[model samples]
Target: MDGSAYGDIVAQPNWTRSTHDSKWAGYLKSSAPDNTSRRLAVYRGSPLYSRLDHHTMSRAQLLKLALPLVKTHGFTREALSRSVLYLPGTPHAEPLSETAISALFGDGDNARRTLLDAWLDDARTDMKSAPSPIMKDVLASRLRRNEPILRWLPEAFGLLISPPSGVPPLDPSPALKHVASIADEACHIVGDTSLGLSWYARRASVAAVYGAAELHQLASPATAYEFLESLLSSSSNIENTLVNTEAYAKYIGRSWAGIIKSSGVF
Candidate 1:
């Protein structure tokens, strides 16, 4: 999923000691349960061997370059194309064409979803680094980052869940994944390391609160904080009742359905 288009520059004798050793170390560890050495050899033989430092960049790299442009271009393909212009070194002779953009990101709504996911991931990263480890403050910081692209978010949310004309609606897993990620990250930040049913409850409750708060922000930006606080006030009860995995899943589903309905994005 995170492969890069560019190939390696100079093949190193020791693959483990390559410049991207640190980056791939975790990958190697995770894949060690399988035949790690054989997999490593295959990757070394592959074109993407020098992916970390190459003339061309990965989609993740391109998206990172494109993120700042979202403020001006509102998550359009134009913003991604123009991202090449703002690359640290010399700019590309021309922007990426529609075909190239689609290939790099995806076709139709998938492209926008990819961009939205990248922005959300970046927001989570920012949230992780906040000075305050408090859940409320961390979530507030996460919501604040959305202000830059708030105008386009409702449309983004719709595209994330709605399919093209004549196509069936897509699963809202991506949106749900991001919400879970935010909830998980907030728990990690707040040092909530409980196991068992409580883990599921805490995450589900946080995700529900954040989902509602974010939608409330779209309608009433000024009072969203107050609304969030009110939701948080009752989160304990919500968590207690969501101990069952099925119940927690339903809670999250309802939260997201409400978000879609209230945003008029369905």
Candidate 2:
């Protein structure tokens, strides 16, 4: 975990914490808006992770440090290596070996994937902190965060949907999970306390809308908010349809199972 090195970095100017033992952890907590902290408390799945050990803390700092380099280095190991220089007087400092980068972040695509997760999670949290209760405004806040790295988003998206095997036929789970998290945060922000099947349906609809709006944003950032509004307007129909279909499917499946059991087909 390089605990000693993390301690040294914590001692650096601009990172000292008078209130908490872990300076960097305190810094991260204080930096987020009060609303964000509340939302994070309600949804432990939110990106403001709680396990703040030296390893986790160091990686968080490293990702933040490396984010800017993405503009120049295109989410490559070179950027991560360069970011090490900023953490001077540490075991993770400059001349970062490939092994160190691999240890800090996994090797190959997984490492860049981690970087993408950090970027998206931060954006999602920022979206939750928007003052507006309107879903479209919240989504817009999130999409706008991409502007700084918009030029490279296609590559990031590619990394996101890319299969871990590095083969053709993209895996959508990573992207799906990302959107689902965004939807969950949005629902929390808007005070949507839906439960049962409705909870799943609501989040599914929000995720679908946000996902489409995000893709639209990539092509036409100027009109993305309008597209998001249109999607939101139609979401009720989609949610109703999904809920009915889901309910019907469950009923039919259970009835068939009951019939089969009664018939002693086995």
Candidate 3:
């Protein structure tokens, strides 16, 4: 369910606007005039439901579309409850509110990570299914993973603990090899040196060492050691805490351990 689906809707906008008298599920049915051009229509709209404009999909339609995804994505009341994806309840059970569902989904790392992996997989699948004969290039694959991780890991790992919803910040450790791997791969995908350079400049300014250098054990050991010495020097302030945070620690400790373990470099 994406651009193509929306395109089909837009190709024929025959949806009747919701009048909000009774909460009935909405729909879009296509009656092809010549198999090439069809008149598709939507029905049973609700005031409580939000409408998708690209192709006039009603809340009922969206919920139905999400049914399969929800089922595949561990359909706890969490996602639907938050309205991230609409899920409706009729005259029988108490509807789960957004706040309650969000609280549940954001409950713990295990839950969040499980959700994260699921999202990454979904995004990956959608991207791979692009109509433009999606390329399986390394960069595309990396970006698929990177975008989601950067968008979610900060909160999941408690990096950007109070980040805004949907666009979470990256609080990942600089030493995390996967961070460098993904970033590099994403940059390679865009094939734009300027953006890549800009990205490196931004990450390196505050980071003790950037992802790539640290991950492949290329951290200019001498330079990094010198920088660390300077960082640890006479800074009896919160500034000290900033440089030695979770991301940096994970990069140096866990990520390094992983790389070493993987390479049999023990």
Tell me the tens digit of each residue's lDDT in model 2 across 22-136.
4333334322222333432443443333533444455556666666667677777787777766542263435567887888878887778777766675566567567697777
In TM-score terms, candidate 2 sits at: 0.69
Span of ten consecutive residues with least summed lDDT in model 1? 5-14
lDDT of 1 at 244: 63
Ten contiguous residues with the weakest lDDT in model 3: 30-39
Give candidate 3 misplaced runs (Cα > 4 Å): 1-80, 89-107, 130-138, 141-266
| Per-model TM values vs. the true structure | 0.69, 0.69, 0.25
Taking all chains together, the TM-score of candidate 3 against the true structure is 0.25
lDDT of 3: 0.35
Residue 60 C-alpha lDDT in model 3: 27
Cα lDDT of model 3 by residue, 1-266, tens digit: 34444444333212122222112222322111121111122232432224334224433233333233333343334434433233222222544464544454444343334344333333333333233331224323323333323433333335323233434454344224334433443334435354433455423332322233222223233353344334323232433354446458768898778888999877
**Model 3: how far residue 44 lies from native, Å:** 14
**Cα lDDT for residue 93, model 2?**
36
Q: Mark the regions of model 2 whose C-alpha exceeds 4 Å error after superposition.
A: 1-26, 29-56, 88-95, 167-169, 240-266
Pairing residues by index, what is the TM-score of model 1? 0.69
lDDT comparing candidate 1 with the true structure: 0.69
For model 1, what is the error of residue 57's alpha carbon versus the real structure, in angstroms, after optimal superposition? 3.2
Measure candidate 2: CA RMSD: 8.6
